[model samples]
Target chain A: MKSSIEVHNLTTAYGGAPVLWDIDFQLPTGQIIGIIGPNGSGKTTLLKTIMGLLDPASGFVKVFDQPLDKVREKVAYVPQRESVDWDFPASVYDVVMMGRYRKYNLFKRTKDPDREIVLQSIEKVGLSEFKDRQISRLSGGQQQRVFVARALAQGADLYLMDEPFVGVDAATENSILNLLSEMKNEGKTVVIIHHDLQTVSDYFDYLLLLNTRLIARGTPAEVLTKENLTNAYGGQLTLLSKVVNLIKQNEFPIREKDSDV
Target chain B: MNDFWIILTASLVAINSALLGSFLVLRKMSMIGDAISHAVLPGIVVAYYFSEDKASIFLLLGATLTGVLTSLIIDFLSKKAKIQGDASIGITYTLLFAVGMIMISGWMQGNVDIDLDCVLYGDIALVNMDKVIVDGNLYVGPRAFYIEFLGFAIIGFCLWIGFKGFKLLSFNEDYARSLGIATGRWHYFLMGLVSLTTVVSFEVVGAVLVVGFLIIPAATAQLMTDKLKPMLLYACGFGILAVIIGYFTAVYFDVSITGSMVSVSTLIFLAITVLKRRKRQTKALLKSSTDLRG
Candidate 1:
């Protein structure tokens, strides 16, 4: 099968400093692929690059054998939750209606059929009741669901989401996983920027481990090994665990006067 | 009869500013209102120097060109020069405004048509003097009023046609771009509208009061409603209310009309803020009493 996403030597930078360096990967179509990385690992940058929100320094990205702009209607992107201002005054219905904006002409209003699609997408996410509620009133998981419903309304063949599972409740997580599985069964490609390591093996079929460069790219069993993780994280997990324990037990103090005995 | 035209002209200016201000407030570009209002000074001065006509269409075109230039410079400074957004706005406006001041004093000194005081604090009481004549006797209202009314119609039409694009651009820029909306062009279109509205309205309500109408009414309406359509209606309502109250109050108290109008706008915002807070406190109190009874 042809690859759904093909990145050839993709490098991206912010300001003068490079964040992603000479990364290359080819993701096969119709699978739930998770991009795992440590902090400052360019996972978000990679996603933004693929979505054409951020320009690549010296590389290219192809979705389904075509450039992003040529096939924009066939792709949907879900930005990170923190990247959007939740305090914005928009209803759940209004936001989902934005997904249908692509279907209308430049100056045309959305019709009843578009509204029907939005309603169905909202129902798919189980947020039909909260359709009229302000987006700011939603819980974290519901906010994420609103985003997913928007992507669902697009009815695209490829979906790119950045950190979709972060800070969601257990029920929301399960529902989102089921939705991903459903999409995969429909022969759509879903690439998610994921963080939690424990669920990596269960949630995703393919893993693209990244930390400034391509560390590993293969099946979960092949890429989630101890060596691959160490290569991506660089002993940061052990260091972070020790530091966390020290802070939790009050065993470390930044100031001399703060040390009680 | 004089007061009728005065109120109508001022209300028209208020409506235009408030209409464009709604989007600016939502986009967190309220400062752009202030920047454009101030930056239009040099353009007006340059136009008066070249054309020598205070109410010329060339003047409007010149001011609008400079306004768009101001936006472009701010973008270049913030994006390429790495200057922060607030600093870029401050630097661009103050520098352009100062240059305008120098042109007024150094070269165009004693020019009765345009001056520093008129630019900073407009002469709305004299708005009736500049009338547009069709033939020898046909009067089509004051030129300033017609200009402001034209501005209002253009902005309203644009909003009607491009409401969806503006909403997407304001609410979520990245998502708008992903949907293949031309976010960059929409951004420039909005800035252009802001510039045109400020230049036209500044003749009646000074540069400072233009910023007030652009932000205060829209912000007050925002506090009143959660949806975009109602927010626009409330903003226009608040703006017209300010014009009527401010005009009558200025007549009765013999004070500055522009200052009174801005004061009324600010007071309306403050009133809504206090009312919302009181409602919140009442809800909290009721919730606590219910918990105790339970």
Candidate 2:
């Protein structure tokens, strides 16, 4: 079977400074893959480069073994929650309907079948009741789900999401993961930029560890080793473990004072 | 009465401005319109210098070119210079407008028919003076009206055809690009349309008050609706309403027509904001009371 995504020597930059360097990865079809890295570790950049949001400085990216533009209709992208203006004059339904725009002619209006798909997508995300609500009025999780519903409405074979779990409640995160599992069961590929390391193994079948470059890529059990974790996190594991311990103790982590007294 | 014509013309101006303004307001680029309106002055001056006539097609072309150039310069400064978008706009128009004023006041020396007063306060009353006679009948009410009408049609058609693209680009530029949409091209196209609209409407409402027409009605509609289509429709409705009321008020009080129209829009915006705030507070209070009883 052909890979769902292929990248060879993929390098991306903003204003001539490299953000993603020498990225080479092949994601097979019908699997849930989690990407984890530190902040500014080119995780989002990799996703954006793959989705064709940012042009690569050099090298190439192919989706379904074809150029991205030619296969745009076969791919769905769930952008970062903060990338969109919440105050924009659009309801949840209107936003979902936008996913169908690529399927129709430039001048053609969205028809009943499009509306039905949008409704079904909303239902899948468990937001059918709030379909008419203003996007700004939604909570962080609902907003994230709205973006997922938009991707679902596109009915693409491949879905790429960036930080879908950020600021989301546990229940909403579970539902999102469950929805991704359902998509995977139906032979759809789901690539997500995830942040939490503890849930990485439980949530994803495959893992792509990155730190401004490719650190490792394999099954979660093979890729989430201590050495790979250290390389991807860069000595922050101790600090992160302490913070996690504080949370387990039902206390917030204390910060060191900047001024030495 | 001639008052009816005045009201009708004002309404038309309002509708045109409001329709285009919705997109501008949503993009949070309202100040760009303000900048283009001011920067077009230099173009007008250059055109008059070359043609020695305000009615020449050269003047319109010059103005449109300068308007588009102003937008491009602002965009370049914001992108290349790393300046904030608002600061770039502010600096660009201020410099261009200063040059325009200097050219008019210092070089022309009040000799040319176009002056500072005309740039600041347009002559809407004189719109009826020039009429088009076709087959021994007055067909076009005024040259200014026809120009504005043509502008309205062009902007309306462009926005209608490009509605999906505009919506996608404005709301999430990255998503639009990922979908293989050329966001930069759409951005420039929208900027071009804005400049065109600013030039066409310059003769009717003057430069200063064009910002009022472009911002206030759409902002008011934003407070009332969360859908793009309704927001645009309501903004147009609100703008026309304000224009009619402002025209009558201007006539009755003998005030500046443009000033009256802007003031009317501002008033409507304030009213809607306050009303929405009150409604939200009431809803919150009711919900709190219900929770307490439960």
Candidate 3:
């Protein structure tokens, strides 16, 4: 089986300082991979680099054995939910239709088939009822689902989502995860930038633990060991464990300084 | 009867500005439109100085070029100097406008006459004097009308054809770029269109008043709805309405028609905002009442 995405020595930066340093990874086709990291761990940067949103200072990113730009049609991206202005005057249907725009000629109107695909995508995301609703009126979960529906409308074989589960309710998150699993079953590679450690084992088949660089890449069981967790999280394992215990007890956990010096 | 023609011409100008303003508001580049309006004055003055005539096409072309150059300068300064977008626009427009005023006072003092007061507060009544005769048929209207009409058509066509791209680029440029859309190209293209419109309309509305024409109607529509197509249509409707009503008001009062039109637009904006606020309050009250009953 061939890898769907290959990033070798990828380093990206905004101006002079680098955001992602010496990142390397290979994602196989037809698998759901979770990219877990701390805040500013370059998870979004890695995804953006692979998607050709930002040019890597020195490295190569190949999608399906070709340059990312050449294989753009085969890849879909769902950016961070906060990247767009919800107040923008567009309906859910209008946003989904945008995914099909690249397939059409610049001067040509969207064809019937494109419209059908957009409708189907909306239906797939359980947003058919809200197709005509203005995007600003939808809740957070619904907005996230609308963007997912847009990616589905693209009909790409590979999807790169940045924090799709952020601020979403449990039901919406489960539905989105299920939809991603379904995509994997259909031989699509889905790479998601996920934050939760507890759901890592169940949600993804592969994991890429990153802390501004490649920490580990393997199955969840293989990479989520105590040693790898400590390396990626950096002395925060006790805090993570306490939070997990608090969640299990239905109480919020607050961290305090252990001034035992 | 002459007042009717004045109203008609103002209405056309309003319609053009409103349509173009819709996109400008959406992109949040309304200030750039404002800047181009002022910056084009130097171009017009220079062209008039060289041609020794006010009716030369060179003036229009030069104004359009300078409008585009003003946008580029703003973009460059914003990027290079790390200045805020609005600040860059302000600096560019003020400098260019000052230069234009100096040039008008120095070079074209006695040779060609272009009134600075008329440039600041347009002369719609005088539009009847600059008539173009086509095949011996007298078309009694300002030459500015034809230029603005052609500009509006081009802008309308561009907006109609590139509606989806513009929407995508405006709303989510990063996503658009990742989707293989050249969002930067579209941004520059939209700015170019805006500059073109500003140059053509400058002759009719002046510089400062064009800001009202570019931002007011769109803002009024924005207060009313959250749908792009309807917002644009409503803006055009509001603009035409303001122009008609303001022209008559100016005629009756013997005052500045441009000022009246802008004041009417501002009033419409305020009215919509108040009405929307009241409607929201009512909905909130009703929702709380239902919650209490439950």
Candidate 4:
């Protein structure tokens, strides 16, 4: 089968400095791939390059064996949860309806079938009761679910999500993981830029360890070994072990933490 | 009787500004309204220097061009020059406004048609003099009213037609672009409308006061609701209401009508803020009470 995503010699930069250095990868369809890296490790940068939001300084990204612009309808991207202003004055229904905008002409009203699909997407994420509620009134997990429902409503075959599990409750995380698995069962591909190391093995079948460059890519059992993680994490592995111990003790809550160190 | 025409013209200008201002406020570009209004001063002065008339269509075109240039300059400075957003707006508008002020004093010293005071605080009372007449005696309406009315129609129609695009562009630009929506073109289109609205309303509300109608009404309405369509409707309603009330208050107190209108808008915003705060407090109190009982 043809690869769902292919990146060749992809090097990207901000200003003059390079963020992604000669990154190459091929992701096959029907698998959940986790992209794990340290903070500022070009995980989001890779997703942005593939989404065509940011141009690569060299090389190119192909989605479903075609340029992103040509097969845009086949791909959906969920950016970081904190990227948008939650105070924006839009209802849940209005935002989800935006997912169906590509299907209609600029001036045309959304048809009944599109409405049905939007409704189904909202219901799938268990946010049907909050359909008319303002999006800002929702909790962080609900907001993340809203974004997922929007991606679902896009009806895309390939999904690239940026840190969807951040700031979400355990229940929301479970539901999202189940939804991602269902997508894979439907023969679609999902690539998630993930941060949590503890659930890496349980959540993803295929893993790509990265730190500004490709460290390793294979099954989680193979790539999540100590040496590969040490290469990806560098000196931060000490902090990583502390976080791992906290998770092991089931005391680490996923909330925003700031440290002066 | 004359107050009717003044109120009608002011209300029309308010509606136009409110319509475009809804998007500006949502996009967090409300300061662009202030920038364009001031920056158009030089454009109007230049156009009047050539045409020697306050009601020239050339004046409208010139000011609109300057408005677009203001936004472009702001974008260029912030994106290319690496200046911050508010500073870029400030640099562009202040420089243009200063040039306009110098032109009024140095170049066109004795021009009978232009008045700097009137430009700053518009004289709605004088709008009756600039009547649009067809054929020689057929009266249409005050020229300012017709210009602002046309602006209102164009803005309303554009918003109606491009409703979804504007919403998507304002809400999430990356998602819009990924869906192949030509996000840049839609962005420029919205900026173009804002410039046009600023120019069209300038003659009635002056440069500075127009900012009030642009930001205050939409901001006030934002506090009232969370949906885009209703927010727009409420903004228009609040704008027209302010114009009517401010006109009467000006007539009663013999004050500056523009000042009265701006003051009334500010008062409405403050009132809404207080009321919304109280409502939120009440809800929190009731929730805590229920929790205690449980």
Interface RMSD of each: 1.6, 1.8, 1.5, 1.4
Name the lDDT value of residue A155 in candidate 3. 92
Q: What are the TM-scores, per candidate, against the unseen true structure?
A: 0.94, 0.89, 0.91, 0.92
Minimum summed lDDT over a 10-residue window in model 2 chain A is located at: A252-261
lDDT by residue for model 3 (B1-294), tens:
566666766776787788778878887888888888888888877787788656566776777788888888898888778787788999999999999898878866886577687777777778767776787886666666676677778888898998887778878888888788887788777776766766666667777798898899988988778888898899989998888888878878988878898998888889889999999999999999999999
**What's chain A's TM-score in each predicted model?**
0.91, 0.90, 0.89, 0.90
Best by lDDT: 1
Off by over 4 Å in 2: A240-261, B46-62, B102-113, B133-140
lDDT of 1 at B128: 88
Two-chain DockQ for each candidate model: 0.56, 0.55, 0.55, 0.63
Docking band of candidate 1: medium
Candidates by lDDT, descending order: 1, 4, 2, 3
lDDT of 1 by residue, B145-216 (tens): 988888888888998998888888888898888887878888889888888898898889888779999999
- For model 3, the docking class works out as medium
> Over 4 Å off in model 1, which ranges?
A239-261, B108-112, B133-140
Query: What value does the interface RMSD of model 1 take?
Result: 1.6
Residue A4 of model 2: what lDDT?
Answer: 91
Reference contacts preserved by each model: 0.59, 0.71, 0.66, 0.71
lDDT of 4 by residue, B175-276 (tens): 787787888778778877888787777768788899999999999999999988899999999999999999899889999888899899999999999999
Q: Model 3, stretches more than 4 Å misplaced?
A: A235-261, B49-58, B107-115, B134-139
For every candidate in turn, the CA RMSD to the true structure comes to 4.5, 4.8, 5.3, 4.0
Give the clashing residue pairs of candidate 4, or none.
none
Best by DockQ: 4
